[model samples]
Target chain A: MPNTDSILRFEKVTVAFGGDPAIEDVSFEIRAGESRVILGAAGSGKTVILKTSVGLLRPDSGRVFLFGQDITEMKEQDQFDLRARVGMLFQESALFDSLNIEENVAYPLLNQKAVNCPEDQVHARVEEALTFVELGHTLEKFPSELSGGMRRRVGIARANVTEPAMVIYDSPTAGLDPITANNIMALIVKERDVRHATTVMVTQRFQDGAIMARYKYDRATETLVAATPGDASIAGLKFLVMKQGRLVFEGTLAEMEQSKDPYISKFVLRN
Target chain B: MLDFLKSPVLAVQEFVFLTARTIRNLPVRPHYWRDILMQMDIIGVGSLPIVLLVGFFSGIVMALQMSRALQTYGAVSQTGPIVAITLVREMGPVLTSVVAAGRNAAGIASELGSMKVTEQIDAMRALGTDPIQKLVKPRLIATCVMLPCLTAIADFVGLLGGYFIGISLLNLTSAEYWTGAYRALEYDDVAQGLLKPFIYAIVISMVGCFYGLNTRGGTQGVGLATTQAVVSSIVWIFALNAIITKIFVSF
Candidate 1:
């Protein structure tokens, strides 16, 4: 389905590593204030898509537009200036080993030209961001001393401290226990609910599809479709499933459930 | 072994390509340059005292050994000239390069490699910051400037060490050793030794950063790259020193 209200749009974006396809000609739009999830199994190029959006990897072809500007072709200085609006929670959390939690959270903010906050105010804001992740007590701790969940929380805090309009989360639940993953997912959804960010999440977790109402307005059909829950189509959601870089299932989530296709049935079972 | 060579070559090619990409993506805004200068001081200045101490001791020992061997032939007077020539033309540059490979190269490699492994380098790129300009260029610039200066200091101090050893251990007068030393060192020897560290610094900084930027596998991969950067940089320093000496001193 075509989209009109996309704050972020990828037009035929393709990324290849060593001439082998990692993600190919995949395109999607994330509207402003929308919480969209890219769901796929292992080795399904999910993280690749997230990284490309944040300009970590350049596409071999096609353009990435943010708010009607071609960000892919923008100069580095321009991109750095533009990045105040976009933040990423890396898969590994990517906090500096030398930096304490406060310094890590305030990193992006300190780099900003507009932030006039003093050191104490910066500390306060870092504390505030950490509190959002329920990490207020760990302010003085170094990144090396933090546990994996704590590290992810720190990453999220750092990514959002600048109050970015767009936030990208790459595998926010990987390598965590069920409860912790659920908690992280809930925090992500809560941010989407309370903040004005266009949340772009890439996850393999089967439960995330059901945890929130991720709706997309299909311009061509002029219909509001949603992502299904319980790792299956909830009621009526417009889903376009891709496998091996080709769109396989493009229909309402209910239609996918009702289909007799063994692949769909097997996918449902596997999830 | 075949896979090993193939992979490094592929990795080097990728590094060059990525470096080119970074060059094109060079940021116009200046980052916090004070941090870069401090990193240089850490890489170059922090290593200076050790390099100088090593240089002086090596020269003094060499002079003592040579004077003992030459005394039987009544050629003990030649000790100052030999010590001065060797220190200025060979030992000073070579030793400083070795120290730099250990100090600066390892430091640059580990910093960038850890950044790579942890995804901070990728984060920089994601935020439209060029790692080469932001991280590598300052290091390379700092190394190129500092290594030669260290070499010069080493040569001067090394000659002084030889002078001190000659007077104390060789039963040679200070006047005699200074006279012989002054006679043997042409500006040619000083220039030759002085030139080697420039290339040495460049090689160490570039190879260190290239290996780091190519880091894969995770923490283990970054650790291995850091070790390899130091070792390979040391080997290159000595080999290049020999090659340059042979070229210039062949006459």
Candidate 2:
């Protein structure tokens, strides 16, 4: 049975570049307010899936449904309206180098017609978003002026500024150091908990997924606390393991850990 | 073999599609007026000094060369008409576009190629803005509008250079030079001069955008795209100049 609450659905989608399939026959459904951590090695099509979900890359075959509308054959202009409800952080943070942090964060608000954030309120919203990422003081700075971790934080602020219904992070901590990577993960957790936005994170690090599964953000304490057993938020969390353009595992953390398959086991045992 | 020809053929198809889409979007809603103004300031105002310098030098050289040829035919006084005709018909538009193609095309390619390799282009798409509408159209409009304006300036500057040379070196009066130069220009010559740059602007902006958008690999790819943009824009500028000039000549 199809979950009518699904925020994003990829039905037997195959995406290719230059006659080479980047992702093949992949199917997944992300429901509203649920979190999905997609784990894979480089070139496993994790990023491709995220891009296709947002209609950045159209699949060669199969259909993609976002917010109950089929986007597979939607015109580019129509996709822009649909995409306004979704936010994405690219692997490199992908901040517009030409714009300062304030403008970068305010991009969707100013550009997304569906967002329709009025001109007068744009500054306040940008400041609030930057404050959410703890980078309020860096508004005047450009992406090139910031450190790698700072840029990623700015990217996060930009992605969430629209208060999107769903947020996708593509390897938000791909090249960061351990401490910084954990800090980013904590922010992701905080965002997911606070906004209750549907979260889809793609990462190569098992620890990133582990962190998502094991912890929940406590608003009062403003810190991550271990979820009590069978907590609904934690229970709603799921894992997806991809290998060479194919989804090999999709289940809870425990189910993924208990898998007998060598590839799935490798991901679980790595950390 | 057909396999070898596939890449270039596909590239041509993509270029045509990109151009068509850009033209189609010209009247579309949500027009990025701010972006268009910014690009105009960059591509048009930024290239003014170089265009002026090139135009001046080209005129001086033409006057100097034509003086010697006219001396043999006892037509040394005809230097102004010759220089004016050449500048308006050929040298002014060609030199200005070549300059713009070198300056703006390379800049556009590197700027956009960097954005592509870093996934900012993808990010733009995901952020609910069409990269083509936001990025490419502004450039296309700016270049198309500005290139001809720049060429007109270059043409006037080139005439000034020729006038200076005619008075000092060729021993002609200002009246003699200005009168000949002014009378030499016709509506047809001005039309051709302006028309050529407008066409070259399309080639320069579109070729740069096409290569930039398709860039891959990384930083190295940006450098490659910049080079390709300059080379291709200049090549197309010359090829197009010949075709346009031939049509004008036949008319």
Candidate 3:
């Protein structure tokens, strides 16, 4: 069973901009080693919630706890320290264009002072991260020179380089081709399983969430194996369906499919 | 109308707030010295040739016009002192700042506005990096340090150009032109020359960063920000120059 200790908790958080609420009274918690997928359509404030979790945006009311510490009241410098342990993959794969692939991957580590290493060690670590994302050969290349899929992989490498305790992925496969999307999803799942890291992935597609919830990384075959009947690891993946900045449904895929709620039914069987 | 006055007031308030935040981040840790050096090269070294060209031409034009006016008064020999004083006290710093406002200010705004639209700025914040420290302060310090140096270079070049024009066109002797120019310079004139560019530097850097960081929409927004940065920085340069000149006169 995943640890009951919560890695992230948002209690009745209300975030608004210019007197209009983006996400209102949203509350959810993810336990350690558990991955929670936030399913939302366009403009449903999924990105706002993720930004609030990292203290990039402050809520109008309510509290956010990270690793059991209240970050709502933390100082900016203290928040910086907390954010170092939380990795985020932006929707646009926001790789630093001014930096080469290796430097982009090493950015979080060097900028956050999360790792203290000599030049060679930093190089080795960057190479290892890019290798994990299957882009080791592109280390010297600039992000502008890379394809969209390659840039996304570089972003993943950067996010995972810090080995964050909690990883937040905002539409990790939003605009990719099916094959590239699947590859990115597989990479995400592999990182989660290998590190047992708690993850919060927000996606518009229901299938992406189901894929993460129902697969386990097999070391022997080096692949994502489907979970068998009564697999406990399946419980580690939970889903939260959001509509217009509010959570509409929360449960397993089976439960979501069987739900009588018209919205959930329509969403679960969407084209 | 009340609404008409409120927008400018709000703009001033936001500008003041940004300046305060930038100052607070200046002494804070995690200083990006490497970015500072890069900005120095971009602002100082990259803009040197343009500054020289602008200064040289302005000096020649000023000498030609002043010699004509003085010739009517039967005082063509006074062109050297008049041109030297005008270039040192006013034209050198003002023209250099105008060029920088168009070049560096627009460049900073377009670059940062593009980053903002592309989500790189948000990514930096997510990665525990303060955009103010990493992005703004380096450019801020670089502009401040380089503007004064650039102005000095421009002043020297302008004086040389004026000397060449005075000896060639006005038929003034080389020794007479040099003596008049040297005699026209005072401690206060030199101080004011250096002081104005330094002040203009702050205006240019802060306006660029302010508009850049506040950009929205997309590529269109970046274009708007670049235009606004240059326009606003130039406005502040001229307005602040008036204020500073008034204060210097009183002193």
Weakest lDDT window of 10 consecutive positions for candidate 1 chain B: B21-30
All candidates' chain B TM-scores are 0.88, 0.99, 0.97
What are the models' TM-scores? 0.83, 0.98, 0.97
Q: How much DockQ does model 2 earn? A: 0.92
Q: Tens digit of lDDT per residue, candidate 2, span B1-251?
A: 58999989999999999999999989987789999999999999999999999999899999999999999999988999999999999999999999999999999999999999999999899888888899999999999999999999999999999888999999999999999988989999999999999999999999999999999999999999999999999999999999998999898
Model 3 misplacement above 4 A: A1-4, A117-119, A229-232, B1-7
RMSD in angstroms, all models?
Answer: 5.9, 1.1, 1.9
Q: lDDT tens string, model 3, B50-71? A: 9999999988999989988898
lDDT tens digits, residues A19-91, model 3? 9888988988888887888998898889999999988889899899888888887876678877888888999
What's the fnat for candidate 2, on a 0 to 1 scale?
A: 0.93
Cα-lDDT of candidate 3: 0.89
What's the residue-level lDDT of B52 in candidate 3?
Answer: 98
- What's the ranking of the predictions by lDDT, best on top? 2, 3, 1
The lDDT values for all models are 0.75, 0.93, 0.89
Using DockQ as the measure, what is the rank order of every candidate, best first?
2, 3, 1
